[model samples]
Target: MRHLSDADVEALLPPPAEALRLVHDALVALSRGEAEVPPKPTVHAPGGAFANAMPAAYPARNLLGCKWISIFPDNPSQGLPTVSGLMVVNDGRTGAPRAVMSAGALTAARTAAVSGACIAALAATGAPAGFTGAGLQARSHLRVLEALGHLDVTVYARRADARAQLMAWAEEHVPRVRLRVTDDAREAVLGRPVVVTGLSIGLTGAELDPSWIATDALVLPLDYASSVGPALARASVLAADHVPQFEAVRVAGTLGEYPATTTWTGSLLDQARPDGRIVCQNLGNGLSDLVVAAAVADAAEAQGAGHPVDTGSA
Candidate 1:
């Protein structure tokens, strides 16, 4: 077996455009029943933290993998990463273990890649965008948005330091896009054609006013109902990457009073864009993890970039 560090995974990751293409393919396959992905099961931790076990098989692409990822929202205060995990890629033919790679970079990449696909398929290029949360997902999404030709973005972050840090990073990395930071949530989202929320899940009193969102905006909530709550989501054409997972989460009370009619995001890609507000809650999907992790494993093997481990017996 081979082991890849976070840095190695980051270096092996596909560019935003390529990443988006990969995720788009996976989503399409999933929609067409060409992949096997069980709903991810969650386990809880102290302090409102949780972890998920995501397993998926993409026989069309000859890929198989599972990711164990955890989100501890309070970690940042302790100078630790909020998200961390590992991915195990298996041989599609024999089910033999192939590689164990850091999941952080891959998770962020695939997530932003999914959002990129949504933006490309749903919204106009360079439309004004708003983002809530200035963390890892925000940075990753900024890269994707820039790749998709979105040049104007406004971000809302409660912490001045986070906003400043993100701004500085954007200036150096995504120089083409202009970023405006705001402390007010309404100011960030009002009338924006694209709005992405990445705030911590399980957060209360952080939901945006439904009136603040444009009637035709594309709202992508990566963080469940943390920032995009029930009332706001109820007013939109709600869609999710996996309707079963969304329904499960709703049953668990994460999404309260959500609209009964929900469509799969991939299905929307094939159909005419629905009129009115569109909220696509891309709850993380294992098929995406399988696709991306397989790519990373292939790259690692080709470049000889990871550390090989010898399992004595197997």
Candidate 2:
């Protein structure tokens, strides 16, 4: 078996354009019933922390993998990342583990790549975008947006240090993209052609107002309804990356009062862009992780990255 660390996974990630293409293909396959991805099952911990087991199989792409990831909202208080875990890539024919790699970077990459796919399919380019969180997911999204040619952006974060860190990172890594940091969430989201929310999930009293969204804007919420809220979600033409997963969460009350008119995001990709505000709540599908992880594993094998471990069975 090949063992890949977080650094290895990060180094082996596909380019932004290629990542976007992979995610796009995965979504299309999912919508067409070409992929098998069961809804992720979760185990809870104290203080609203939980971990999920996400598994998927895309035979058409020759991909099969499972990701075990945990999200602890209070990790930052202890100077730790909020999300962490690992993924195991398995041989499609034999169902034997082939590679194991860190999940943090892969999760962030696939999530943002999915959002990039949404932006390309639903929103117009060259317009200033807005983001409401400044964590790893937000930074990853910024990189993807930069690759998509959406260079001008506004970001709103509650912590001064976090905002400053994001600005500094952008200056060094995504230098072509200009960032405007703000303390006001309204300033970050209102009237933007594309707006993304990555706030901590399960927060009460969601603040964004539906009226602030433009009539023709694309809203991608990575934080469930934590930042976008029920009112804003209800006001838009809502969609999700996976309809069944979205419904599962809605039935579990994670998405409070979300409209029942939700459709599959991939279904809208090939159709004409719909009018009025659109909100595509991407709950992060396992199929995307599987596709990207398979790509990473293939690249690692080709480039002689990651150390090998004996599984004894083989």
Candidate 3:
């Protein structure tokens, strides 16, 4: 079996544009009910950090994969990353483990690609757009927005400290994009026809002013797992990366009540929307991970990337 390190994963995966394209195509397939994805299950215990296992299958390619991700939100105290994970790729036919690869980079890439897809879809509608949160995911979305289209991205965070830190970093890295630190959610949401929220809203329970979202605007909440759905129920167009995943979480009783005109991400790709409010909530699906994992593995193999596996198992 091939093994890929984080560096290898970074080098092997497709470029941002290519990854976004793949994600767009994949969403189309998903909306057509051509792809298969499983719900991610989480287990938390006292004295232990939160961890999750996500598995997914691709029907078209006959592939199966899983990502084991853990979030030590307090890991910063140890000078470590807040999130870490790995992706295991397996053969659908024989169930043989084909590769063990880094999931962190893949996660970033896939997350950015999904954001790109949503931005492109929403941009097609011609409306004022804004981006909330200024973390790694928010930066990734900015990169995607730069590559695919143009949209005004605004940064909103609970702490002035975090916002200042992110703005300094942005000035050094992404100064071309319009970015401002907003204390008021209303200021962040007002007049923006499209908005992307990349923070862990589920964990923070941050609420947006209902009046800020114009009746004609569309809100895309990329982090849906921890999001309170009822707050966004009034949105006219509610699009999701995967309806089943949302339902699974709903069944698990994790998501509270939210009303929306339910539509899949695939639907956006298949047709065009003229107007009306559209909100796309991304809980993230395993199939998205699997597609990205396979692409990374293939690139690694073709380029002779990754660390040489030692016979430690032997």
Please give each candidate's TM-score: 0.97, 0.97, 0.85
Q: Best candidate per lDDT, number? A: 1
Clashing pairs in 2: none
Tens digits of per-residue lDDT for model 1, 161-199: 999999999999999999999999999999999999988
Model 2 accuracy (lDDT, Cα): 0.88
For 173-246, candidate 3 gives per-residue lDDT tens digits of 66665667786666777778677776553455565666677777767776553432566655567777888767
- Candidate 1 stretches greater than 4 Å from native: none
RMSD of every candidate to native, in Å, equals: 1.2, 1.3, 3.1
Supply candidate 1's per-residue lDDT for 113: 95
Q: For model 1, which pairs clash?
A: none
Residues 29-101 of candidate 2 have per-residue lDDT tens digits of 8788889998889899999899999999988666788999998988888999888999999988878888999
Worst 10 residues of 1 by lDDT: 253-262
Query: How many residue pairs clash in each candidate at the backbone level?
Result: 0, 0, 2
